[model samples]
Target: MRDSLSLWFIVKNYRIRSVFIKNFFIILSLILLPVTGFSVGIYQLYSKTVTEEISSAHLHSLSRIRDMIDMTIREADNYSIRIASSETLATLMSPSPMHNYDLNVNVLKMSAELNMMDTMRNFVESVYVYSEQNRSVISSQMGRWDLEQFLDQGWLDSYNTNKSQRKAWTVARKAKTFQSESEEKTLITLFRLAPLLETSKLGSVIINIDTARFMNMINQTGSDYIDSVFIIGGDGTILGSNDLTLINRPISDVIPVKDIAEGKPNEPVFVYEDESKQSVSYVHSLYNDWKFVSIAPLKLYEDKAKYIRNYLYISSLFSIVVALIISLVVSWRMYMPIKQIMSVVSRPGEWLEESPPPKRVNEIKYITSSILDSYGEKRELENELRYRLSLLDRAYAIALQSQINPHFLYNTLETINWQAIRLSGGENVVSDMISSLSQLLRFSLEGEDNLVPIRVEIEHCKHYIDIQKIRYPRKVDVQWHLDEKIMNYKIPRITLQPLIENSIYHGIRPMSQEGMITISGQLEGDSIVIRVADNGVGADPDKIERINQELADKNWITANNHIGIRNVNQRIKLTFGDQYGLHMASVPGHGTTVTVRISAIQA
Candidate 1:
């Protein structure tokens, strides 16, 4: 019972069902848009927050490494100044040859003190003193040697190259203090002129630092986030770096010098290399003007936001799936009612599909077409019924006009015709007129059908003309120029008689001389045209205009003077349609012409 009621309700409201699926999708989009936007917004916010946090932490670590490197180099510079000013080193470097015993004691004391100083700092590789006047060298690790025999000649060359400076640090270079050493050691030596108070420079004190040990100290201050580190001199030279091959080279060769120059004193800058991006952070040292730099991969910073990005992807996919399911379920529920209505209204073989169908077979369109077709059929039936009723009314009106004892009038006319023939003792004009009158009355009263053959209508018109000829005597003549093919065509009964009547009474009767009435029939396309013309004094232009206007406007009620012509025009249009009707034309002294047009219907 519930199913039946549901079906009944659905069938009754099937007119509005087409918009259900369209509206469902609209609502689904409204719901899903916000869900998708919110998920994306949350992911972007979280990713931005995480990236900033990681960049801040990495920058702080780089700053700590910079401070550590600066302090170490400051300590090395202070100690190098102390050794250069020592009296024992200055006396040993004098040009005068010292007594062998005193020279040996002074060298022993200086070597012991240098060795102790080298041991104080883990980054310091060795310490030595060179006597330019004696051409001798003293080392903290090795005892003494003549300048030519000493294996570590790189420092002497470096010191000689920049002798004008009171103190300076050389670029990284290889050194060997002993002949038996298999491999050269990489060093950055600090050279200072001896005897700080004297203007005459005799010799120099040197401090050799191991590049590897220096870099190891820098590495200790760093974290895994850093890809590499370097200590760059003010002249753009890489004075210290974890990669030994990069040491002593221009820092601009490995990183763009412009990028570093663009950064503020202590800040991070980003640079892109072919396929990867790196973040470079550095701090400038106030003591030596050297830059402490750290390079880290940018991908590592973005990795911290991966969790939020993954959640966004998952949430977006889930939301899309859920929205699709909800839209489909809702649309299908609404569409089921329309589908049921389609099945009930359509023919037995024409059921709507449950799945999406083609445009022509859509449930709503099919139902709409069915309803429109039914309405058209109903309207057509009503029009036909009204047309028949109108014809019956006209027939009844005609019957009323002839209702003065129609049978008795017919009998009286026949009796008069027979008596006139007997009184004349033969067929005379009076008897002929009586016979024509009887035939006209019987044709009008007895015929019930609205349409008659052209031959029959033409015969009735001749009877009217015969009576008119007897009344006018020798004043009127009639002629028929008709086509043989039009004789079989059907026309409204007594159609041509009224046209002839109008021409005789209104056109020929008013003339002083004998008049001629001519009737002609011809085929024009699908219609048959009949023209009735009379040679007499025609009507005035105004009267002709008024009569034609009445016919055109279907003004049947107001047209009393030309009622016969108007009635004939009305009947032809009602029978064959508006396109078939009568048109009148006249001239002041010439005859009048009435043209009758009707569809060629041959039965």
Candidate 2:
């Protein structure tokens, strides 16, 4: 009989161990998996958000640079028009009807006046008159020159043929005085007819412009980001440039000919890579068919974006690592008492049952003596009742662990309130936070039922949703569906709040686009099922499986936020037996859903 009793005792202890292991696994799944997932998700989200912001800023900078180039080209075109329409040129070409004697004296005086006007203009490098009759060139600087040896037939033909048509022609060539081998140095000349009279055709006006001076004016109006600007003629010849060395080179040799040819009439052409393989060029063509090109190195802008991305990644990674370390340390500290209790419970069955009862201290003896004197024989019985009541109260209190510290909650709410006031008071976020806080606090402090009415649970969820909505207004959406018959059923207080908080803070917050959180409850057979789902970053299968394994092994207490699901599970098992509890299912990108099962309570 004694052997049989011992066998029975061993079996009972083994059964208890099995139950503890099962409970451990269930609790682990509810807590650790969500915490780890939340941390990683938030980190990735922060990284992506910072990356997109930097990219947008880079694009804006590129657009501004393009606008600056356009403005510079426009300014250059206006200057060209001004020189073409100068009143001095018109006066010099006016008709002299009489074939007068003293023609040299009159012509000399007119030439001197024209020279003086050219000096005052500053932009004109040289002003000359070409006489077709004498084949002589007279200039302000070069006094007299015979055009026979110096003027090319191509230039003379273009000038003589187009003179009657009154069409101006421009040409780019090495400056007549150039002494250097530098490729960029060159000169541009504008040629037009100066009709001496209606009856007599004598000569034309030739204007030579200093290309460097023209480029300087263009450069002054352009952005500092431009490395160089080019002035290319219609025939793909480099007329002038900010870079002097490129002045006389053919455009086809320096830039791709296809690019300039294929470019739109007025629209700028953006080439990603140039001859140097380092810069990007934006090219625009003037009405005169000269190409205005701005070259800026791509490295200048790309470096900025790269720096920002690197800095953001490093900072986010460091922050997450530090936060995780701190959380682990703090959680371990907070979990000490519960860990001690678990350790005591996990000891060998024989050792626990054989342990001596705690000895009464001097204070307890004195309290007992006082009670005995005051109540006589009834003191012993009343003392036992008081002890049992105290034990019951302690056990019940352990069922609910406040989601956030009271001080933290109050401070956060206070901050939200002030921010809401500043945000122009219209259904402001602070009001929502305060309402959520009030509901959460009321449920924590006054809803003493192990199973609260379903209506109260729904209100708690709504309040939590309101606070999250305020924090992430554009990112999180909440939906609620409830069955009328399940309204009166009771649930453990503070049970669903953590799940909702996890959904918002971990799930919805990580998504770049807006996300939704759903809370739905319905009656199915004899049980009511409540589901909270979020269209957020969902759980990893490997992690979920690992957490399940940890739960099965009763190692979940080693994980983060030990009190959340474990405490709720314990309360449910103690109040309504082991059949009712929480269940979770998830898929990546799609979302996570948590379901709580409870027996429907009759009104």
Candidate 3:
């Protein structure tokens, strides 16, 4: 007997220890293995990825600037061609005979046309036609000037020198405007000879483009990573730039262009350092043989790389700690089922009522017995639940049967109403009252519908008001001013009649003079509002405030007073949402208005 006991102790101890050891290593391996591998190589991978992304972003910005410049140049060339081919310029340039009045009119017309063209583009400073043969220049701003008197005759020299060039874009130069008092603005001119089909023309059409505006366009694309943007010509000259001072200067004078010149022609983008040790990104434009360059600080990229390295280190440390904690949690979760089985075996009195587990039983066999016992308990509970549900279904059916009385009452009222109308044979107050009451009963019996159309609700409300008017006999008046469009929209059924009844009982019946009641409804945004107002005896301001508070109360159903108003408010909220309901306003001796707000739901 002692040998058997010792063997049982050894087997129990070995089973527990083996389970813990096996599960600990298995969970730890699944979690820590991936974390360990990730920690070793992630830093280098992140650094290379970030660097490539930054470089690609810089290259993209350069390309955008190039496209903008190319588009602007194209627009200027198109405008130049349009002005040259205009019939006004053509008639002015022809050597046909004309009177002084016609010549004056043509010159004025050409000046107006030039002025219109100048205002059409933000970058175009001025547009003008110069007639070298006529020795007269008609500018958009300065009007007509003789060849010698023109302030910008410098272009004529180039025009005469380059006679073979039909159209050409001149380099940037300071242009003197007609208003000499104004500051001189630097501009680039596009010169197109007139009479486009002819080898030679009588005059030239020149469009002046503002260089400052070009700088503004380039500066708009600048960000923290970019320092300077430049448009450099193929001959190493800076044609346009964000820095106005650098315009028309040699590219080598501002920054090192040697590396760019040495770059392979097939490569569209390249990065290099300038004299100030700043990194510059260059993009070569195949459209115009120009280079778009953006300068950035090398320290920025290095700082970003350093940040990535530090972040990776911190993340690796955190992941290692989290992995250890997760492994512990997984081992504990796996051990819980075994622990539960032991607890069940120890206390077999709960589920195993007939045949309890033996004290020295095997754990696997005891667990199997516990599962079978629990399944038997579950089946008993399911059977009891089904029996209770059957009782509930019968109770619900009994409640449905209770609605028959209201339906019977509505049918009986309809029959009596028609009989009274037939016996009267003509317009009788008793017959009309019975008809209205019967209609009211019919509307009230429609309990299956949660919502009814506004038109139907209004008709039901009118029936109630009609009966009240007969009882009061000209002592009360009810008016309706509802919108025709909102008639098709829906509201909670039997909502408006209760408020009308409340208005007559509480507001108008106590007054000595004739009382006025107004029912108005209209759509306001996404909601519909209907107000029932009476001008008879109003409540005290404090009492009105309390009634309004009760209308807004969330637990209004439990209150005793103002049952009609509270019921309507609660129904609106339950049907639509808490955001919709009723409100009340009144003065002590004047009147009260109960307003109903509901969502604009279509039937």
Largest TM-score belongs to which candidate? 1
Alpha carbon lDDT at 100, candidate 2: 40
lDDT digits (tens) for residues 196-252 of candidate 3: 665668778888777788677667856666667877776667767767777778877
Over 4 Å off, model 1: 1-48, 86-120, 165-167, 178-181, 235-237, 250-278, 297-310, 330-603
Ranking of predictions according to TM-score: 1, 3, 2
Clash numbers, per candidate? 0, 9, 0
lDDT of 1 by residue, 307-389 (tens): 66777778888888888888868766776756555444553223222323336667666665565557557668889789767
Query: Which of the numbered candidates is closest to the native, going by highest lDDT?
Result: 1
* Candidate 2, pairs of clashing residues: 25-551, 183-245, 184-244, 184-245, 184-246, 184-247, 451-491, 452-490, 452-491
Model 3 scores a C-alpha lDDT of: 0.73
**What's model 2's TM-score?**
0.37
All models: lDDT?
A: 0.77, 0.59, 0.73
Clashing pairs in 1: none
